[model samples]
Target: MSYGWLDDDTTISTDLKTTKETPFYEPIVNNFETGGYNPSVSYHYNPDVTQYHYGVRHPMKPFRLMLTDHLVIAYKLYEQMDIYKPRRATKEELLEFHSDDYVKFLETVTPENATKLAQTLKKFNIGDDCPVFDGMYDYCQIYAGASLDASRKLISGMSDIAINWSGGLHHAKKHEPSGFCYVNDIVLSILDLLRVHPRVLYIDIDLHHGDGVQEAFYLTDRVMTVSFHKYNGEFFPGTGNHDETGLSKGKHFTLNVPLQDGIDDESYTRLFKSIMEPVIANFKPTAIVQQCGADSLGCDRLGCFNLNIKAHGECVKFIKSFGIPMLVVGGGGYTPRNVSRLWCYETGIMTNMKLNHKLPDELPFRNFFQPDYSLHPNLGDRLDNKNTKKYLENLKNQLLENLRYMKGAPSVAMQEIPPDLQNLTTDEEQAIIDKLNSESSYDEYLENERYWINEKDQARKHELVE
Candidate 1:
């Protein structure tokens, strides 16, 4: 179902009506100049046209105000980084991962078709989970293009790190749509990288498993898929069992760490450091893709975890610590306001920008919810819990065990198998051929891959002079 938070017309005006008497409406925008703002400081809030009468019925609306407020805070911080720029993704780039047919379908979907498509929601998997709104395709393309832009920036070497807070719709598949995702931008971006790099590492931190991406590359060793998410049982779209490793040459390439709910920052960090860090280091990938889904946060509507904002920030920090080219994307976050702020704060940290403490005075729908510093407050005040510490220690032990196992593990190099001379069955022979083909393509693939490497060189040159 389309969460009501996605409504475009719900603006700061709604928020003001609900919490006008509270201290939350204190204006904090007097100190900053609108002229210094980054054009990329996009605000998704739009005022509702219908005037509200006294005692008029309204849906649960405070969450949207929270998102807009957080975004205003984030945008103020983003200004310090000077990294907001829009870039387009080329057709060849999009086709790298997506089917030509699907790409064409996305381009052709119109408002009329959207209505008909909505009627047959099951056919397209576009009802409540992923509603076919008026501009759904356009929104998908914007995120898809933004992801492509981030990938291009990395490939070009313009910046070692980049983030598209709007991207990370990871549930979309090659031929079908699932969840709220219409396009698997992460997969497409990875496909774009395969053209330039021999090995790419993908990490998904969304509370839900990155099943769509895992399915796409289940048989390829060139891409290492690592996902850490909640897996209690049949939680949204299922899949992502630990045993669901890659097939053939890709068998051990996929790693699924199913975490329990209520995992706090310390435990989450320990899991990353102990398990993901070493695995990535050993793999020695040229690039990394991270989906920093905000749903993992404590107060998310759909999430069961208890992680605060600092915990989310730590995930970004940990990934960026690798010093490899990294692209950060946004994923699930039902508590739009909180998650947006979380991401905004993350972007600031990643870009080496100073974090701003203030928010806009008058926000769209500012009155919708009373801002009790206790209920939906800032992360600066929350303290780490004891459970977080214990979880970390447990994760450390797991990592130690894994490292010991790896010490006695076989070499990563593939063993050459001679062609079968005996008349083996065609199907059996084809399987072997497929494995060899995937392995052999790695070398020649990287050589001819044309990425935005030159553009990155130019951007870096420009940054140096500036």
Candidate 2:
């Protein structure tokens, strides 16, 4: 069997007999019929993260996580990946990136005492965007913990890719919260990766800028953050701009692709590949952390981009082909229904399972997907594509020019691989060990790197030969 580049339909063929190695390329052509999937993808989720309510009027809903999980189960996508209910993040773990004062405040603050602590709330930027709700502290721990566990799995060589749909709260700062995010789980997870990997790459596809994450690693070349978001004007937490690269040692490291409104799938993907291909080559990061925010999809309540579910997922498919250890997390999505659909679809993408378009009858909240009970619904054209070809060409040139400044992928002096933290393994540790022994090692998998060296040569060449 042989696999080629992604086409319009996003189909690719691969040798079915190849050992289950990286979670990226090997495709189970008919997983639904065979009940098989790549076992290297570990899914870290806790049901408790879905139980918390952010407030009645607030757009950020934890219930969407529940919906996404239900959809994954209903589609039998869980059969493809190892699932674990990760532990809540300890205060010590949170302190790795968050300040002691802020960590203590998140632990102690509650709605009952919020009125009296108005001044404290103001200081932390937790007014309307980041409100004090019941179980808010516990909720933050659960999500942050899932992300930490996901990153740990990648670092320990236990999983090729780990995902936490409840994480990716990228708007939270070191000492304050912003844009409905209370904890910067992405930042915390990246810090964890830096312990083992010399360099880490962060790519954010949220409709809003990943300001909190960009700011956290702006001064260090150890982590390179690339955020593609709707920029300019009065966008909330507006910071991502083409000119706002990085500072000091990290001058050319942080790359921001500031897009205009109503960018469609073709244009969005073109720019994504154009910029990402070179960035990945030049940075040569060992691990990657991608924030797959569903708010960027078309018809989202707050998002202005005109991307469909398939288009949004194309980014994940392209990235996975690189065969890098990755941690995927959730971010700013207002339409809970679409958010659930987008994430569930992406989960299938990660596990290399081709999902059925029709929603399963047994899926919970089935009625919520009314009118058309399909995974990829027609969100219709709500906004015109403001991004012209000329504008995109020029923007691509500017970003590529900046890459020329970098001498090459920064080299790190060889050091001893850090010992794994002294944490007890979960109940399924033995089963995981058995699976790891049966699969290919990390070095062997990287040796078989299936990369598209040139975007122009392999753009839409799709075929799954068998």
Q: What tens-digit string does per-residue lDDT give for candidate 2 at 1-466?
A: 4533322243544564431322322244744543443438999999989889889998888999999999999878887898999999999888989999999999899999999998998899888778999998899999999999999898878999999999999999999888988889999899888888999999999999999999999998889999999988568876888898899998988888888889999999989988898899999999999999999999998999999999999998788778789999999899989999999989988888777677776788899999898888976478998889998999999999988887678877747765445343654666677778767576566554443334335666584322
In TM-score terms, candidate 1 sits at 0.65
Model 1 scores what on Cα lDDT? Answer: 0.62
Where does model 1 exceed 4 Å of error? 1-75, 79-93, 109-111, 114-123, 354-466
Where is model 1 poorest over a 10-residue stretch in terms of lDDT?
46-55
| After superposition, candidate 2 runs with Cα above 4 Å error | 1-39, 414-419, 423-466
Best-performing candidate as measured by TM-score: 2
How many residue pairs clash in each candidate at the backbone level? 27, 1
